[model samples]
Target: MIRALLDPSEGEPVQIERAGGRSPVILVCEHASRTIPASLSNLGVKPDTLTSHAAWDIGALATAQKISQLLDAPLVHQRFSRLVYDCNRPPEAPDAIPEMSEIHAIPGNRNLSGEARQQRVAEIYEPFRQALAALVAARTGPSRQPVIVTIHSYTRVYFGAARHRAIGLLHDRDRRLADTMLQQAEEHGITNAMRNYPYGPDDGVTHTLRLHAVQNGLLNVMIEYCSDLIDTEKGQDEWAALTTRLLEAALERFDIHAAGSQQA
Candidate 1:
């Protein structure tokens, strides 16, 4: 039998926030936590690396929580570090359990028995998928479908170069929501908003969008903020407010109402 990677006492693999919210938006922060199961021993990475962006998307969960509150939306997030098993990545992807993140070699992930890998998938990835899927299903209907929005953060400097983009709106083949937000962001005085900047769908970053939104025929978009912009409570609040406004405007532009509101 495969040993479980996560201790049940530690915590569940997924965390849901505002599950009873009335909004039609379902927010996701796949890299919300940087927690590693004690069994992994920090994946043999340095202490500092555990806190870095490689482990989780810095400031994303806080900003996502604020946005979920502001919009009264439901949020589903992962509770373990992406280094354990990236919830956003497909299981077959090499980086799903990366051996090397940026310049840091993850010694623990270098050689893994198939059973060990499956344990991470069973303990972490599967739970997140189920929770998110259930949340989406609960909100979707023939006349109304929830909009899926994912929050993430990127480092200011990568590979010795400064990233000047303040925000990025990423999308896969479906750009319905992202296009509207990109245009509205610029009009809202966020001139630095770029489409597919920092990371694009081609970078294998849109698995969640493809798996949940696209397959379900629901509108979706992924928002990326620079780490420095939302690393503080003040910054997280500011961005959450700004993002809420943009999302509201986008929904209005599309003439979309919150799912089940008509019946409510």
Candidate 2:
């Protein structure tokens, strides 16, 4: 029933959303939403679980929206349960089709045979990859060098564990973006911002950054918002503004301007 109800053609991919013309930049949110269709009642999830971190990034969707709006850049977001399949994950990872993400058991995804697994890869996963390829392909111009920016969020605590830290900016050796953003966040008085923790590009092994950024050797940066921070409307606005300022400032120093611009 769940499979039958899926509307892949409407651009309701295991991922979704794309906009703006060519730019030197691309924004991707891998854990944007947790919306399964009307069928299977969340593929057999309990009520509480459907709205939890296992499903979505908690605040990433709204944050991504704000960033896309502010930057006037295209954003591609994953639209289904990360449990059904994590678009950020490489095809071969064991947890690529996670039966359980953290504490939530995705009964619908458990123990599938090779054919079933491959079908999911074909039907849902492949379309997204192809669309991404198309996005990259479409981004050709005389002055543009495509830079991929991936948006994501993390739980404030690990397994309900506690941390005094408020936020983190996760990157790996991408000094151009990371240094600038880190400095901007600090100068902006975002006192609790950590340089990198919980996870970094090294930690998110099969992440979208690896798929597109590292593979293509483009400028890539991934930001992780702590869920508790952007879990509210006011919170979203504040962080979005913060992100925009820091990123724009950073890009300028790096001489990375959006393509299709007057400058470009």
lDDT agreement with native, every candidate: 0.89, 0.71
Q: Which residue pairs does candidate 1 place in steric collision?
A: none
Candidate 2, which segments miss by more than 4 Å at Cα? 1-11, 14-18, 21-23, 38-41, 172-175, 258-264
Candidate 2 structure quality by residue, lDDT tens digits, 90-139: 77878888888777888877777787677667755776777776786677
Candidate 1 lDDT over 1-264, as tens digits, reads 855687779988898988988889999999999998998888889988998888899999999999888778899999989999999998898899999888777899988989888888888899999999988988788876899999999999887899999999999999999998887887776789999989998799999999999988889999999999999999999999889888888988878753334323
Residue 249 displacement (Å), model 2:
0.7
Write down the TM-score for model 1: 0.96
Q: Which ranges in model 1 have alpha carbons more than 4 Å from their true place? A: 258-264
Deviation from truth (RMSD, Å), model 1:
2.1
